[model samples]
Target: MASPTAAPALRAEHLTKHFGRTHAVEDLTLEVAAGEVFGFLGPNGAGKSTTIRVLLGLLRPTAGTAWVFDAPAADVERAHRYLAHVPADVALWPSFTGQECLDLLAGVGPGTDLVYRAELVERFGLDPGKRARAYSTGNRQKVALVAAFATRAPLLVLDEPTSGLDPLMEREFRRCIAEATGRGQTVFLSSHQLAEVEAVCTRVGILRAGRLVEVAGLAELRRLRRSEVAVELARPQPALDALAGLPGVADVRWTSPLELTLALTGPPGPVLRALGDADVVRLDVREPSLEEIFLDYYGQAAA
Candidate 1:
C-alpha cells in the first residue's frame, strides 16, 4: 500500500497547452492522490485529451507544469516509469497475436505480472491466439486495457478506455478499475461515460473549453444538480403559488389537480416544509444524474 504521506501520483499546477491559435488546455490545476481513481470529464474538444497528453509527457505544457510521482511530466522517461497509458484509439501491429502484443507491451512498459495478465485476458475474453488484424474494435481496446491492468505501474492513465465496449465489457472494465484502486494504484480516467465515472471514480473534474470548471466528489456534484420533485396532495392542496415562490424552486407546474412538479436546485428543506403543510399523498425526489449535472454546468456556462 502507498504511504499516506507519499507524493501525489499526478499533479498539475496552472498547466496550459496552446496550439498556434487554439488553447487546448488553460490554467488547469488538480491533483490525484497516491491511491485515488480520478475521473477527468469533458465533452469532445473540451481539452480532455490534451490534458492527458500533458500528463503522459507526450506533450509539454506551454505554461506551468505537471508531475507524476514527483517527476516532472516533461521528463517523460522518468515519469513514464511509474505510469501506464491506454489511449481511446487502440492500434496494434496486424501481424502480432494478442499474446505477442501483450508480451511486447510488458517488455517495453513497466514490468508485468504474468499471472495477473493471464487473468485479465480471461476476464476480458481476449483470444490470445488471434492476430490483431482479425480483432474487432472492441477486441483491440480489450488488448490495451488488459495489458495496462496487468502492468505493475503505480499510475494508470486511461483515455476513453471503454469506447468500443458493450455493456458487459464496460462492467468488466469498471470491476478491473475498482480492483486496481483497491490495490493502491492511482487511475486518471478520461471518459464521456458519466455513469461509468460515477460508478468507479472517487472524485471527478469537469473541463469546459480548456478550463477546469468544477472538481468535486460525486455526492457533492449531485447536490449541485437540480432535482426533479413531484408531489401529490390528498384533499386540501395547500396553496402552491407560495410553493412556487419557495427558495430553490423553478419551473413549477401543476400536472393535475393534486399533482405538482418542479425543479429543485438547492436544499430540500424549504420545499419539504411546504409539502408537510399539505395533505401530501406521495413525494418523489429524483436526484440528478451525472450526465444531468454535466449538462447543467455546460448550460450555465453557455448562458
Candidate 2:
C-alpha cells in the first residue's frame, strides 16, 4: 500500500480547458480525498474525458490549476509517480502479448506486485499469452485494469473502466475497487453509469455540459430528489386538495378516480398518513434513480 499523505489525492481549482471556440471543461473546482472512491458522473461529451486528460498532463489547462498529491498536474513525470491511470479506451502495442504489456507497464510505473498482478490476470479472465493484436476490446480493457489494480500507487484514475466488460466482469471490477480502497488507495472514477457509481462511490460530483452542477454524498443526494409513490384505493379519494396540500408532496396525479400517484420529496411519513382510511388496495413507493435525480437537478443547468 502507498503511504498515506495529508494532501488530497486530487484537486482542481477553477480549471478550464478550451479548444478554439469550444469549451471542453470550464471553471471546474473539485477535490477528492485520499483513500475514498469519488465518482465523477457525467454523460458523454460532458467534458469528463477532457478533464481527465488535463489532470494526467496530456493536455494543458487553459486556466486555473490541477494537482495530484500536491504535485502539479502539468508535471506529469512527478505527479504520475503518485498515481496510476486507466483510460476509457485502452490501446496497447499490437505485437506484444498481454503479459508482456503488463510487464512493460510495471517496468515504467511506480511499482507493482507481480504476485497480485498474476492473480488479477486470472480474476479478470485475461489470456496473458495472447498477442495484443488478437485481443478484443474487452480483453484490452482487462489488461489495463489488471495493471492498475496491481500497482502500489496511492491513487488510481479510472475513466469508464467497465465500458466493455460483461456483467460478471463488472462485478469483479467492483471487487477490485473495494480491494484498492482497502489498501488505502484513492480512486477518481469517471463514469456516467448511475448504478456503477452508486455501487462503489460514497460521493459523486455531477457534471453537465462543461460545468459542474452538483456535488453531494449518495444519501444526501437521494434525500434531495423526488420519489414516486403510487397508491390505488377501493374508492375515489375525497379531499384530493387536502392531500396535495401535504408537506413533501410536490406533485399529485389522479390516474383514475380511485388511483393517486405522487411525486414526493423529503419524508414519506406525511404522505403515508395523508392516505389514511382511503382503503388503499395497493401501495408502491419508488426512490428516484440517479439519472432521474440528475435531470431533476441539472437539466436546467445544461441550458
Candidate 3:
C-alpha cells in the first residue's frame, strides 16, 4: 500500500552500492512523487545505471535503504505487478513479430485485459508483421515502448528508453509518456539525453561520480542557471559586448536584425538597464533549458 504522507512513489535513503573497492553508487537519497516524471541524469559511469539496478531490486545495495510505493525495493517480486521497465537496448525473440512480442508481454503482466494494446500499436507506428531480427535499433526501441505503454502499469522505470530513436520517433515517445502521465502514472526515467528530460520531466536528479549532486524541478534548475534575453531595437545600436561582464550576464551576442541577445546568469534587470538609451522595440526573456542547466552543473563539477 502507498504511504499517506506525501512520501513519494520512489525513494532511496543514503543508498550505496559498491563492488569491492569500486563505489558504483554512493550515499544517494532522492524521491519521486506519484504521477510525476522524474529524470535521473548522469554521464556514463556516473552510477546512474547502478543506482537504478539497486532500486529495481536487481542488485542489493552495499549500504542504506530504498523503497517503492512504501514497500522495500528488495521486495520487487511482490511489487512486480505494478511495474514495467524499458531498457536502453531492448532485446526480444528474433523470430517473433512486433505484435507477438507485445501480446506476450501484455499477457505476462498481472492482468488479462488487452485494452491498451491496440492503442500502443497505433501510437508507436509499429508494423505488427515485422520480425524482431529485421528491426533497426530505433524500431527495436519502438517495440519495447509499445510493450511498456501497452502494459499500462502504475509505474514505469525506463533507462534511456529512446537511445536509438530518431527525432520523429523520440517525439512520439515523448507523447507516449505524456499520455501515460496524464492518467496518474509514475515514471522513473534515467537518460543521457538531457533534451528529452528537459521536455518531459517535472523534477530531475543529477548524479556525478556515483553521488547525487543536485535534485530539483526542471524549472527551478533552469532558474539557478541563466535567462536568455533577446532585445529588438528601433535603430542600430552600439556594440554591447561589455554587457557580458555585467553581474548577471554571462554572454552577449547580436543575433539578428536589430536584435541583441544576452545570456544572463541572474535577473534581466541589470542587462535591461544597459540598453537604456536604445529604442527597444521588444524584449523576450527565455529561461535556460534542462540541457543548459545540467551542463552548468557538469561544468561546475569538472572545475
User: TM per model?
Assistant: 0.94, 0.93, 0.83
Each prediction's number of clashing residue pairs: 0, 0, 0
If ranked by TM-score, best first, what sequence of candidates would result?
1, 2, 3
Off by over 4 Å in 1: 1-5
Q: Report the C-alpha lDDT of model 3 over 53-103, residue by residue, as the tens digit.
A: 898888999999988776688998755666778886688889999888877
Tens digit of per-residue lDDT, candidate 1, span 1-303:
233248999999999999989999999999888888999999999999999998778987899899898789999988888888999899999999999999999988877889989999998988999999999999999999999998888999999999999999999999999888888889999999898998999899999999999999999998887899998888757587688788889999988888889999879999888777788889999998899899988998999
> Of the pair 1 and 3, which is ahead by lDDT?
1
> Can you give the lDDT of residue 261 in candidate 1?
93
Displacement of residue 62 (Cα, Å) in model 3 is 0.8
* Candidate 2, run of 10 with poorest lDDT: 294-303
Q: Candidate 1: lDDT over CA atoms?
A: 0.90
Model 1 clash count equals: 0
Candidate lDDT (C-alpha), each: 0.90, 0.90, 0.82
Candidate 3: TM-score?
0.83
Lowest-sum lDDT 10-residue window in model 3: 1-10
Over 4 Å off, model 2: 297-303
Error of 2 at 256 (Å): 2.6
- Cα lDDT of model 2 by residue, 57-101, tens digit: 889999989988879999999899998899999999999999999
